[model samples]
Target chain A: MAVTAQTTKLDARKLRADFPIFEQTFHGKPLAFLDSAASSQKPRQMLDAMREFYETSYANVHRGVYQLAERATAALEGSREKVRELLNAPAAREVIFVRNATEGLNLVAYAWGLNNLGPGDIVLVTELEHHSNWVPWQYMAKKTGAEFRMLPLDEHGELDLGALDEAADGGNVKVVATGLVSNSLGTINPVEKLVAWAHERGAIFVCDAAQAAPHMTVDVQALGCDFLAISGHKMCGPSGIGAVWGRAELLERMEPFLLGGHMIRSVRFEGTTWGELPHKFEAGTAPMAEAVGFAAAIDYLHGIGFDAISAHEHELVSYALDRLAEVPGLTTYGPPADRRAGIVSFNFDDIHPHDVAQILDLEGVAIRAGHHCCQPLMQKLGVAATNRASFYLYTLPEEIDQLVDGLHKVKKVFA
Target chain B: MSDGLDSLYREIILDHYKNPRGHGVIESADAEAEGQNPLCGDEVSIYVAFGEDGETIDEVKFSGRGCAISQAATSMLTEMVQGRTATEVATLDKDELLEEIGIPLTPVRLKCAMLGLTTLKVALHKAKGTPLPEGIAGFDELDLK
Candidate 1:
């Protein structure tokens, strides 16, 4: 996806028609959404696809010989291929569906951690890692006696590459897991370089691409990482679905993380033989309708074109940063807008994050506040939380205007 | 900005957030415990200076960074609970406090508003060395407030 900086205005009237929820008023006020980083709003296409699946063809996959079951199985497997295409994954088998990025990362930590890492092994994480990516490794370190280390952030809230390179090239690291983009600060990490550094130390590199997949084009093969995890909900899909993309050979070599009925081909009271590569990890019945919804989400994005969507969001965030700069005593977090995605974290002098959010909500402007699943980043920034206004493809400059207008309201509340 | 914001940012609430009351360490206190909202990342370490005289709370102090609702509730709590018995404040109504602030809150914001009193109730129980009542820490769900 080549995003060449869209100069066109994002038409709210046209974009709002794609999202049905905009029709309803939230708290007796017109909703001005700005919380896409938390969970993106779904388009009608995705919702309609899920409803169609349930209404026309709904059955348990891979368990029955009935016609409906066969169709459901085909559709579920087809969604896996859609995800593979979406990420430019080399093979469809590398895409394993899971509950969300949290679950997908946990699978790698539990299965890969138990097999590859042991005493004296080191796993390198970073300050910008989401707790989902950080805590699982911490638990693995505690269980297997592997040392858990962190790559520090630079003064500008981006990764300190010199420090990361020193740790990565030190030869003590067995695995490296970091975010492709910072969810809190929106700093896009140098994944291409980080992957090379980790591989040089004979370590496997896994990227948490939850933030990156939603805002930019993701190519797992091009990224040259062993594995990448992303949630469907963040990318305009429904909840309860996500995918983990890994190299086919690596996934085949890794052990199964979760065990249940659908994961095994043959079972005895004492032991069981696992199924094929992807199915071996899918425990119980999967979120079938959700997988279909995810496919529709990819189709919806492809329709608008990912490059245009990303460029539109970039234009909006840049405009927002400029407008927010005019607010006195306001401090924006993370790297400058040019280097980051659309997520903007900031703090206003003499105002708490909750107050800012509450004031914004009164104006019908939705924003996210609190640790944002990055408590370590918050600790490093020396603040408990910051108010974040993140945008998606459907978000408009008018909404950014509303956010700027809302900040003035926030200042007045505390003034 | 609108005239409606004035109610939410009442003078007392801003005063407390700007200059919190009863800050610092309360040494040799009878009871002390820390409570934090992991959802919003707001924390408060409250120290209770209740004596063997029991019912009366000699002092209470809290330290945390949160919205005006939490800090204002804390500041008002220290003033409301000083020299009053633990039982009296526990029975004290939460609705009256919001009525004083004169701003209605959403379901989520009400928790920030009540975080102080809820923690105080727990600190009181710790002072008396009694079991905390079930669901005492979470009281914002009902419209009773």
Candidate 2:
């Protein structure tokens, strides 16, 4: 319970028992999973919830009058309530379910962006944004004639606050969108400070919490972000179910994207009337099973405590960074200690990232290679590509040893 | 096949990576073609000198900064194409190249390795004043001009 930052040990043995893939082997060896930033393994609870919904309580919600439909409606609406509890949103109405974080951001950008932004309106984004965060604003800029600008990064990968203030100072910027943690470098942005700055400039702040929500406690009210996006799969939930948590007033003011069946209150040949708040955003027959799975995943996280998950991940990340440094030619990217999350991106000297990934795979250790979907950040880091070995709550120190040993083997092979 | 898995990371592959063959400039080349991997910003340029037969590749060279896959693949391709007929090299398909290298590539990296092949093929076709294949997103636009 005394969660020390670096020395804490987690029993993923119990966690692994919940997810069966850990028992499997890759290339005839126990799989050393270091690609959790891409996606995390789901717990049995989430898997079971999806199956149970399909088998027993399967029905279309709100439209059907059967008892199964009543159960499905309660379950679907219940997941929204759980998301509200998870983020501590003021009401369940604030949490709008979407396909994933990308679509969620697009919903806000297309809806709010279309209405608010004009020729000179500026949207401030960070240098480390994923293409998901970067491209929407660019599309908005192209469509609405707004100017998309970047908040520059310091040497440590933190956004330059002075540049942010300068961008926001004129009050011309409509939105300040940034990621809570960079997926490539594992650099945790100072998002709370950024939110305050955006607020000062009367700019709506949006946080891409895809990487952060899995490892840290997120409170929308405390952070004071007008809109925040979270992907379920990056945590321990199923894909195709993500939530966009916005303030009730903000959600009400925004227009619905993807006009369709479930999102309307009434329809006719003439322009139909729309539903309120969350339903307005969710257009079609939603991913009912996926929503239930996500709700179950939130329960699993709360049961384990998000604080414990954070401590466990930080300890593993610290161990990984330290151990990786000893791999002779390994050069790590991103900020110093305590400035990042469980993600660790590094490169080996004179070796291509693909070679590093291949070498690691030989040792049954999995890692991600290439630009990690952040080409601009790759340009910023001055590397063509990097071999990244990210961590999660279920990861153990022995696996980090496998990565280290694998690096040594790569050095030996290429020496 | 050092570790029973035949690690796409073969000794020959590593050798090609470390001491890449046919590297650097060929100033006397008739035509040059280049390709860039947009995903990671790795660039490759293949320089060629053609024989009087218009198909025989008398000289072949390349220069690039990329993963061992791209660099080593380029090295292997240079070795394979040098002194071969440009028709032979142009007819060199992806499976044949992968077969010669004796390794499987992940879908995307396979394209990285094939960039040199495509570049070599384009250079040969360009020198002959022939038309290029359609729907090649990376280079077709550039070649169109």
Candidate 3:
């Protein structure tokens, strides 16, 4: 095999310096965190942003007439604008902050789904969705007597569009929800095509962009989806903060998911009126510091630029695929490297994924193993679980090298 | 090999994992129960046939798919429980099983290590027509610490 040095655009070494967690070692080995799909490590800039906000500008948002409250409110809303720019959303009012992507997706299912769906209506999703995207719609369908259908995957782990026609039959398909990327298989799904297909059928499309928004360029308008969800922690941001972007018309028509202090206009004995667009959705005190940290994470990504990040990750994943092929009895799932994103899910021989992951930990090569919250997909793939090594902007080729080396070690131990 | 990996995947553990003993189901078993770890989709089913006296464990078997720690630990449990009465086996704890495996396991892996004992305890209690033995009966009850 011709092993060529792949030139990459992102300065990973420089970027790695910005993340303090990378400075540590695990089990006397350098920490090669390959679990970015679970959560990315925060950069110092993002951490500092949260710290600064808590120290100087900490106050409850959308309340209090004092200047401190106004400043706090502005900072929180400023993060919303940053998210708007990141997603290329039409208006800031369309972005609703929630606890995380799970909450965001659940908000859509509860607020929009409960109101619109009923008996004979079909809620269509794909088998490639994470639990966050799959479970909410399933629960909604059960509650509303709506028929829940999943679009099956073809031989290549791609969405079987032919099956979509049959699944969405009777012209009763009301909502189509799917992830833009498969978190387990790392297949970059054809969300744009799916959006178009759903729109033609007079059905609304909801996208789970938890994987895509962080790794690639995501434009809500370009994708033409009615609703989209993203998690802040998956990007270089803090946890406990995520957003769901919906079209203004759709958001306006839907009811508030959680009714509390901030989401109301005026509470009376008779009844309470709801607040404006996005604010109506974000109930109770928001994750102020987390929101600011998330925005800072976005700024950090933007500073490096998405193009370079994609290119760097492309090189790393491709290199990883090549190196992983050298391991005997290893079988990778999903499409080719060119077609997929940074995730690589595979199994070595009949070795259980848990065993493989445990051994890899000794080498300080962190990866995710198990069903990856996609048990249905695992069943479809005819495996109980898989081992996944996902890359990100700061992931170095040497880390992939270390991962390959660890796999060799796993072989030795099992041997 | 690193000490951590070596201790966890000791030769005896891997031996059982590679060539698991009592790995087939008994036909029309007197009592049986299934155990599953929902977190990783690991499942184990234990089948037992009581002795003529209906007190001693006459035959015990397990059929499942999981990591080495789980399968091997269960295999070890099968060997340890042979000929022991239901009440004697009922007293078996996770420490006994862990001692049999001869390794210290992290809290997360401890669940895998204890799946065998959990399943055996559940199967015995179910067969005896008694309520489940108190403490650490379910996979969720395993001391993750």
Candidate 4:
């Protein structure tokens, strides 16, 4: 495929028409949603697909021997194929449907981490990980009597990978987990290098792509990580649907974390055999309608090419940072705009983040406040919380203007 | 500012937040307790001194750092409880202070508005060696360490 300028520039104003939520108003003002990092607004295509699926093709998948069941099964499996393609995985069976990114990480932590990690083993993670990626490994280490370690962050909020030499020295590092993108600071981690470093130490790497996959082109083969997790809701899909893409050999060797109906090949008085690759991990009834929505979301993103999606956000963040610097007493966290994705985290003057969020809410701007579930990072940054404004494909430059205007209003309110 | 915001951050509230009343610790206090909203990191500490009657609160002071609502409400609470009995302060309604705030708050901000009153009540409960007064929804979960 040849790269063209047309394929790399997005019309955010036109794309806003596809999301109906934009039509609504907050406080009688047009809503400027800057919270896409938390969850993206669903497009009509995804909503229609889910509603249409439930109305027409709803049935128990892989069990009922009927036409509707076959169609439902095909639809759900089609989503797996979409997810596989989304992650650029080699096989669809390696992608296991999970509740969300958190559950996906937990599945790997319990199934793979518990089996592979033991005493004298180290599970190393980065300081920038969200609680989901950080807490599960802590729990796993506690359960298996393994030691837990963290890769500290530099003053610029980027991970200090240099520390890994001493941490992984002794070659006891069993597993290394990290987020490809820092959810709080918008720091784009050097995952490929980290993956190579982990492999050199004879360790498996887990990539939390919850923030990266939705915004960039993430290829599992290129990342060379053992497992990668993502949430559908963060990418304009419905909640309650996510996936974990793992290496086939590793997944095949790991025990199934959940058990019961739909994941059993045979059940008997003596013993029962588990189902095939992905089914062994996905227990109980599947999220049929949510899967349909997720497939549509994948199609929606593909329709607006990742190249254009990222380019549009790059423009927005660069513009936002430039305009934000004009506001006095505003300090932004993380590296420069070029080194980050579309997220911007900052604090204004001596004002509290909650107070800033409250004023912005009245201005019809929706952003996130508080620790953003990265308390360790916040403590390291010497702040209790921060105000975060994130962008996506549908976000407009005008909305950034709204955010800036709301910020000025905040300064005045406190002034 | 909009009507809703103006109401939430009334001039009186901002004044109290800027220049908090009784905003310090007592050298010799009868009871003291600290409260924090773990979610947002808002914190408040209350110190109380009993009157010679042993039932009346002779003086009350507070100190903390947080949003306008939390700090202002705590400042207002310190003034409202002074010269009141410990028993009366323990059973006092949250509405008394919320009305002083003069605005309706979201559940999260309501936690901020109530942080001061809750801490004051906790101090009274500890000083009296009595169980915390009941019937306030969403107040029990606050970490008072």
For this target, which candidate reaches the highest DockQ against the unseen true structure? 3
Better of 2 and 3 by DockQ: 3
Superposed Cα RMSD, model 4: 2.8
For candidate 2, write residues B1-145 as lDDT tens digits.
Answer: 3463355777787788889998998996888888778766687888998778767788889987888778888898887877787666666666777887787777777777777787777877777655454324457565634
TM-score, chain A, candidate 3: 0.97
lDDT tens string, model 1, A216-326? 888888899998999999988999999998787878888899888788889999988988978989889989999999999988777666677778777887998999999
Q: What is the C-alpha lDDT profile of model 3 across A1-415, one tens digit per residue?
A: 1112233477989899999998899999999999999999999999999999999999998888999999999999999999999998999999999888899999999999999999989999898889899999999999999999999999888999888889977759999999998899889999999999899888999999999888888999899999999999999999999999999999999999998878998999999999998889988999999999999999888877787777877788899889999899999999888888899999999999899999999999999989999988999989889999999998988899898899998999888
Which residues of candidate 2, in runs, are more than 4 Å off? Answer: A1-10, A168-171, B1-7, B25-33, B38-41, B48-58, B83-91, B122-145
Between the candidate structures 2 and 3, which one is better when assessed by lDDT?
3
Using Cα atoms, each model's DockQ against the true complex is 0.58, 0.53, 0.76, 0.64
What TM-score results for chain B in every one of the models?
A: 0.82, 0.86, 0.89, 0.88
Which residue pairs overlap in candidate 1's backbone?
none
Per-candidate TM vs. native?
Answer: 0.92, 0.92, 0.95, 0.93
Give stretches of model 1 more than 4 Å off: A1-13, A165-171, B1-7, B51-55, B86-103, B122-127, B133-145
- Please write out the lDDT profile of model 4 over residues A285-389, one tens digit for every residue: 999999999999988898888888888888889999999999999999998988899999999987889999999999999999888989889889888789999
Cα deviation at A147, candidate 1, in Å, is: 1.0
Give the lowest summed-lDDT range of ten residues in model 3 chain A: A1-10
Model 1 chain A poorest ten-residue lDDT run: A1-10
**lDDT of the structure predicted as candidate 3:** 0.89
Q: For candidate 3, write residues B40-145 as lDDT tens digits.
A: 7788989999899998998899998899999999998889999998888878766778888998888878888778777777887777854454544344543221
Q: CA lDDT, every prediction?
A: 0.84, 0.83, 0.89, 0.89
TM-score of chain B of 4: 0.88
TM-score winner, 1 or 4: 4
Off by over 4 Å in 4: A1-6, A169-171, A269-272, B26-30, B49-59, B85-87, B122-129, B133-145
